[model samples]
Target chain A: MENIHLENIDFEYAPGRRIFSGAAVDINQGELVLLCGKTGSGKSTLLRLIQKELDTKAGFVMQNPDNQIVCDRVYSELEFGATNATQGNERHRLELIRQRVAETAGYFGISRQINRDTHTLSGGEKQILNIASAMAANPKVLLMDEPTSMLDPIMADRVIDLVKNINRELGITVIIAEHRSDRIFAYADKILLIEDETVVCKDKRSMAEYMSRSQELRGFLPEIARSVEMSPPPLSLAEAVFGKAHAVYVGKEAPLSSHPVLRLKNVSFAYDRSKGALIDNLNLSVDGGSITALLGENGCGKSTLALLSAGALKPYSGSVKINGRKIKKAGENSAMLFQDVTLHFTGDTVDGKYNGMHPYDLSGGERQLAALDIILSKNPSLLILDEPTKGLDYNEKEKLGKRLEKLRDEGKAILLITHDVEFAAMFSDRMLLMFGGKIVCDRPAREFCESNIFYTTAGARLSKMNSD
Target chain B: MRRFENFNPATLLIYYMTVIIPIMVFMNPFIILTALAAGLVRAGIYERKIPVKRILFSAVLTAVMALVNGLLSHQGDTELFFINDRAVTLEAIRYGAVNGLMLAAAIVWFSAFSRTLTGEKIMALLWHLPKLALLISMIMRLIPRYLERYNKTGLAARINEERGQVPEKKHIMQITSAVFTWALENSMDTADSMIMRGYTSGGKRISGIQFRPGDAAVLALTAALQTMYFLPETWHGILMAVLCFLPEIYRIKENVKWKIYTLKI
Candidate 1:
């Protein structure tokens, strides 16, 4: 396979702010390169270039599952490229393409039933389907932009393993731009440190040295990798402790109020008459003056419960109250961000008149941020968001966490349902471990998850704490 | 496998050229019947049970459609029978039935395409095409993405109690407004993406994705079929039309990937 050579390549979206200029680099074939950078450091843009999605033959698995699926049935998506050969007819040929599609689907572990509806599948299933789809496209190069950022640990590892298989067997070159690199770190052939726009350093280095030597490298460190004696670190509680205790708290007192911000009693919701209720007889309470972090496996109804709390969905049999007031519909007093930001950003009034662009054009993370911007700017009394960390780089999530702390200081009852335990822990005073449509554990954020636990951030282990 | 049963778009077109197209243009019943029989045979190639079911379903659908058209479009010879005040002639019914069957066959045939081949694979075959095809493919990619998004959106809206019948007037206004909003946001995003990629204000140019010879050869064949269809000689015209129409067989293929893609959002 041929590789592109860059000589003094320079670029910037806005003038004067050079994202990458006078940069020369050669990326070899058949390597899984990991990119490290802070938010807006152009990691995604770089990936786009490499994947040929932007200007470059590399295939990309879209960050948002919604963006990846182009067809209705999972089988069709797999065979769509082949079936398309005989556009209007070719009935027999279409059937022939089925077995191969099914095989590829199986590679991703996608069951037969889930292939029918791409939207309804779980996050991991969607990711698998997307990867398989991209791989089948037969691109020589693959560039993944935080492909597993939002997935559960087990599923994320599975996807990584799948990618690894393709890389090894098929010799498909892979490039991954990730903030937290625990999953792919040991496996990465080369580490490219992207900081402050330009690639500061590239090539070989020990993981420990790579972690410590560069100032810009700090952002990619796993959570709880630092101990906080006085206050929590910006990324982790420990980092806050070491920086400045009083400043970390920053004139904000720990949440003392125990009043329930949201209360759901005996709630049940059914998607369709045939499949049975998705959530059944569930009871939950999220208290006020405290950052409440909700966690659960995919399809465990974490978002459903969050909706009830946010007054988006009324429980079938039970009642949901926001600060003792029952919710009748979705409106002010509360704002809920959906798992996929595109679902909520369909702005009718804002199209064509301004920039000839729809909210749909933005990437998944951008849409999420945009939705958050709209809700936060609106000054809702209770802020409810779903998978807010999705599509965001590590630094963006941290910035959002810091923003949440500021919002908390402003007395906004923040209720978040997320797959990100570190994100919730970084900001919340309280945490709830939810799975299988129920809360498995609930406790103070300070007393909550250890780094090694499920849903915890990668660098959150006590042993990994940075010693200054 | 029977050649007729192998109705992938290319084969379907070849069969259409040899059969259906001629019948349509020449107004010949023999050609149509001959092609239809061939379809039945080819339909049985892969799995015996599958083709029979496909043919049966196609025939039923076609027959139903033909019956409806015959009943409504009663301007033909009254060779068969009469129902009510309307003259439901055997000739008209036959004509309508044949047309309906064709429609049904085409629909099922195309669904078979989606079943067998995928979009990415087709794209690989068409890799050498101009940027327009790539853009078309990209937009095609968006169809399923949009459908999924819309479905999820509708569900979210329903759960949020923002969904209601409201009145036709309000509904139209809301839908129009939503569509308009969606369009604007999407365009802006495309622009942003373009700008991000250093797309200067001009026609598109390909920086990468050179076509392999295999894909180029496929494109040439496709182009040839398209040209043959456009040629106006009665027999050749018939042939080309049939070939060109083969890809339209799978109605679901034109739609999203989801087996059941409803406007849930």
Candidate 2:
């Protein structure tokens, strides 16, 4: 194993806009490194330089799965990296390439999807394909630019697992850029944080040592690690928050509305006829002045229900009443914020929020906030947000929770669909679970967190352990 | 997958090239009718249902072409009637009808061509041109995605509607600009990703287009039939026309016996 040692690296896009100045780091082979920074802190640029994709041998996996996929089919995408490595014999090249692609695809657990069209894959599958393609290249070093930034919690975990497997099983040096470090920090052997226009490199053993002095860096730590006051924080989140006291919310609960803003009665929907109805004879209602979270696993009809409630998709056989009126189409009084924030940003500059910078140039969290602002400007009675805190850091998620609280106080009916157990428990007043197209459980937020095991929050877990 | 989707691209291209030329060039009503029938038969076998609207549209176009020729061209000897000081000749109308039928037949055959040859199949045939193959497949994937995004943007606009009414002009403009920006940004990211994956690596990659024994047989059949098509005769041309539909006929028969011979996997 050979380590890549970068000494005094300097990079800049233009004059006066310094990205990295005299940045130096040594990345040992077969080690997992986490790169953390603010959105514009040149995290992607640093990764790009490390990969040297335009001029070197390092593999790169992009943040957006849809944008990263170049080939039309999965098999072709898997073959892309192995086929393009210019250093192979002409003899038996095709046979060698085929075997390499098949092996990588199988290892990535996407063997069945090889023949499937790349565009037809789900968000998570596409990200896995991106990583699989990178692995297919078989490079000594792999640089990922927030690979799990756009994935749901469940999907994000799968990507993290694959990355860990690549680091351990393949013994490839893995460097990942991520904003939310809760899931990834545990796997990282070292931490590379960009601050003060320099790369601060710390091994896993000394990361806590450094964090104790750098209060600003401590905020980037996982929720569990930030809460604990140990001199050297625990290695994993489970250790950091074990037997610790948890914060408790005791706000006076706002009463449910007498007249629901959005109502569904006997609603049933299915994308395909052969698959049967995913949402069958379901009844749900959302009223003003409270946040109601719709929680479920991936592909459990949460998004479909969100779409149906927003009137973007009409149920096959059911009544969707908005403000006590049966609507033929998506009502103007209802607004839906899609999971992809970029889908909603149209203005040049966050509408004077960013002093005329392009909306595309905004950070992920800023872009989400800007998009939500645009939707809110429409003054809709009911707001449906899908996975709002999916890839946001702890701070951004807290900011988002505050924004939701503000909206709820303004008497807006909020439907928050998310897989983040902690975020839902923090902000939502009521919780509902949609399993196999039916509302299996509906309870108050705190009560739901107390009862459920897997769907409960980190704070709940800590409190449970403390009690035990 | 369709019956001919997995057929070797080179063989499929050869078959289409051989069949389309006769449809385009030969003006005889029998040849044109047979070509049209063969195209429809093959497409029906592939799709399992004939596209009635497309066929009807072609018929309407043929009728319009014949009528236009009867009204516009007065060069023929046999006159049907005089309209606006111009002779509506029967010969001109018949000539126009045959020409129109030729055009329609060519269209139907080309539709069959498109059905048999996907962009990936084209890429497979041009495997040596890796960059071009990638571009073609990327475009093929991007188009449907662009349309889907466009529709979703429209949905977003509807969601921003006021009092159950669709958005005003300002909202529509916002939606359009947003979608355009997203498209542009997405394209740049896609290009970067492609480069990272070695799209511009200045070397060729092997396509996943395996040529089996059935493909070899089809290639041989196409080669033999193409020679017959180029021959200056009516019988050989007619034989080639029937051969054009051979794959579809074989497909139906093969499907019937598929379970008996092939394992379920």
DockQ-derived CAPRI band for the predicted complex in model 2: acceptable
Give one digit per residue, the lDDT tens place, for model 1 in B101-172.
565544544554454455544544443453454465557656665565456565544433233536656654
Give the poorly placed runs of model 1, Cα more than 4 Å off: A1-7, A12-17, A24-26, A48-130, A133-140, A149-154, A168-171, A203-216, A224-255, A272-277, A342-370, A376-380, A450-468, B1-148, B151-265
Top lDDT model: 2
Native contacts recovered, in order, as a fraction for each? 0.11, 0.69
**How high is the TM-score of chain A in each model?**
0.76, 0.91
- Report lDDT (Cα) of residue A289, candidate 2: 83
Off by over 4 Å in 2: A9-24, A53-55, A88-92, A209-219, A223-278, A311-331, A465-468, B1-7, B33-108, B127-131, B161-174, B199-234, B245-265
Residues A304-381, candidate 1: write the lDDT tens digits: 677666666667788877777887667536777676565554454223323544565554445566666655544666
Cα shift from native, residue A289, model 2 (Å): 3.0
Please provide, for model 2 over A17-72, each residue's C-alpha lDDT reduced to its tens digit, 9 standing for 90 to 100: 88987867887889899988766788888888876733335678888889888778
